[model samples]
Target: MITDLIAGLFMIAGTFLMFLAGLGLLRMPDLLMRMHATTKAGAMGIGLVMIGVALHFLEAGVTARVLIIVLFVMLTAPVAAHTIGRAGYFVGVPLWEGMLKDELKGRYDAETHTLASPPEHQNKEP
Candidate 1:
């Protein structure tokens, strides 16, 4: 009974997170921001849903499979988002106007298609 209640809660939480993620994707103005929404919230939502399923099953095989699904989603989502963001950045996608700083500015060389981290001294804020 307790397990069922807990599973239901987790399922609800997952649904809410996924809904928020969809809202974020629609509301955010930039590619990076949308990516952030989908990656973080979507991954978490899927993970929670999988956890709920595993809990409901309470079987070794099903639990293991669901756990693997959760792990895979958590691991891949961030990497996929980062890769897409980097591609967008390299292709000259503009950041949102309200952005405070551009840490990557001057670090990428269009001519050579190369990127490098700024020097230690340049990393500090005034």
Candidate 2:
């Protein structure tokens, strides 16, 4: 049936994303880059896989559960990644040598563990 083909395509795409996430984890030089890749790709892959499952099942209960799971993951993954990255930075994790600009360089206060807002002058648009 057409539904089955669509489901298969979704699952394959999801699996490919998951594989790319793993590859990124292994290949990325620094913690933040790896986290960015894994979190974005992994969350999307799971969402797609769950959507495919929901479509294939064609049952209300199964679809509802899948939707809940995907929504929860999509909401939480980025937040969790951010928390982890922030913690790592605070703990003295070194960034990659080739990194160009550190936007947080002067804004983050190591003593207070807080980020100060940019000056009002800089906030104004050109």
Candidate 3:
């Protein structure tokens, strides 16, 4: 009885998280921010939903399948997001104006490019 209620509640929570993930994807601006929203909310949404489903099923094979599904999502989602984000950067997507600092920008600038390449280094050139 109590377990059923708890499982029901988890299902509801997971559904709400999935909704929020959709909202976040629609609302967030820029590639990086969108990816962040997609990764965080998407992972939690799918994870909790899978857990709720496992609870509902409550049998060996079904639960094991759910666990496998969760593991796959966990492993793949971040890698997909990182690949997309890196590709977006390479393709020259403009960042949102609100970004106060970019650690990647500093690292890429300092470690690569030349004093004559572009932007920050151009000023240092003769």
Candidate 4:
């Protein structure tokens, strides 16, 4: 049937995206770049997989569950990435050299981080 064929197509496309994400994760260099790979591929992979799976089932409950999973992935991916990035920065993982400017450099004075922050509203430490 045409519907079955469409569903099969979705599954193939989703599988391909997931595989590409895996490749990005493996090949990307540096934490920031790798993080980019992780976030993009992760979201796309899950989204396509869910879309494929949902269409394959076409059941209300399964569709709802897949939607929920998609929502959860969207909500958590950024938070997790920020946490990991912060940890890497605090632990002193050097950033890639192609980066022309480091916005965080002013806030961090090499050996110690300034709690005062660069924000205009933040009070400077005396």
Candidate 5:
């Protein structure tokens, strides 16, 4: 009984996060923001859902598959998001005007399509 209740809670929470991801995709003003929202929320939602499934099943094979799927998503989602964001930036997609910081400013060489590392003094975080 308790296991079922916990599983139900996990599923509901995961579903809510998934819904928020969709809403963010529609509502975010820029490509990077939208990507950020969807990747973070979607991966987390998948992880939670998988946990619930594993708990509910309590079977070796099913639980193993769930763990693998969750691990894969956790490993890949951030890397994929970063790659997509880099691609978008290189393609000249504009950042939101309200953005506070641009760490990449003046670092990219347009002609060679390369990025130089920040100077020694600028390396310190603000």
Candidate 6:
């Protein structure tokens, strides 16, 4: 059936993303980059896998559970990554040597332990 085909494709795609995420985590040079790999690709991979599960089940209870799992992963992954990265930065975790610009270089006050946006970012209104 069409649903099975779609679900299979999603599962395959999710597996591929997870594989790439693993490779990236191993190959990336810095903590931030590795976190990027794990959070972004891993989250997407898991979300897709959940979507495939939901599609394959096609039951109200199973679909709802899968959807909730996906939503929680999607919501938390980025925030978790950001929080970890910020903590690492605040603690002076060295960035990769190849890194060009540090946008947060002067944006943070070490003594105050507070972060402020860049001038441009501050001026912009949401």
lDDT string, candidate 5, 7-95, tens digits:
98999899999999999999998889999999989999999999899889989999999999999999999999999999899889999
Model 6, which residues run further than 4 Å from truth?
116-126
* Candidate 1 CA-lDDT value: 0.93
Query: Over the stretch 83-121, how does candidate 1's per-residue lDDT look in tens digits?
Result: 999999999998999988888898899999998877988
Per-residue lDDT for 1-126 in model 2, tens only?
899889889999999999999999999999999999999999999988998898899999999999999999999999999999999988889999999988788788888888998889978999
Number of backbone collisions per candidate: 0, 0, 0, 0, 0, 0
What TM-score quantifies how close candidate 1 is to the native fold? 0.92
How many steric clashes does model 4 contain?
A: 0
1 versus 2: better TM-score goes to = 2
Model 2 residue runs over 4 Å out of place are: none
How high is each candidate's TM-score?
0.92, 0.93, 0.80, 0.80, 0.93, 0.86
What ranges in model 1 sit over 4 Å off? Answer: 123-126
Residue 93 of candidate 6: its Cα lDDT? Answer: 95
Candidate with the larger TM-score of 4 and 5: 5
- Residue pairs in steric clash, candidate 4? none
Task: For residues 1-126, write the lDDT of model 4, one tens digit per residue.
Answer: 666677777777767777876787788666877777778777777877787788878899999999999999988998898889878876789987787877677566655644335786555665
How high is the lDDT of residue 105 in model 2? 83
| lDDT string, candidate 6, 1-126, tens digits | 999999999999999999999999999999899999999899999989989998998999999999899999999999999999989999999999999988899889999998886788667899
Give, for candidate 6, the lowest lDDT window spanning 10 residues. Answer: 115-124
Give me the runs in candidate 3 sitting further than 4 Å from their true place. Answer: 106-126
The Cα local distance difference test for each model comes to 0.93, 0.93, 0.81, 0.78, 0.92, 0.93
State the lDDT of candidate 3 residue by residue for 1-126, as single tens digits.
776777788888878887887888889888998888888788888888888888887899989998999899889999999989987775669999998976556434433542223467655857
**Which ten contiguous residues of candidate 1 have the minimum total lDDT?**
114-123
Q: After superposition, how far is residue 2 of candidate 2 from its true place, in Å?
A: 1.8
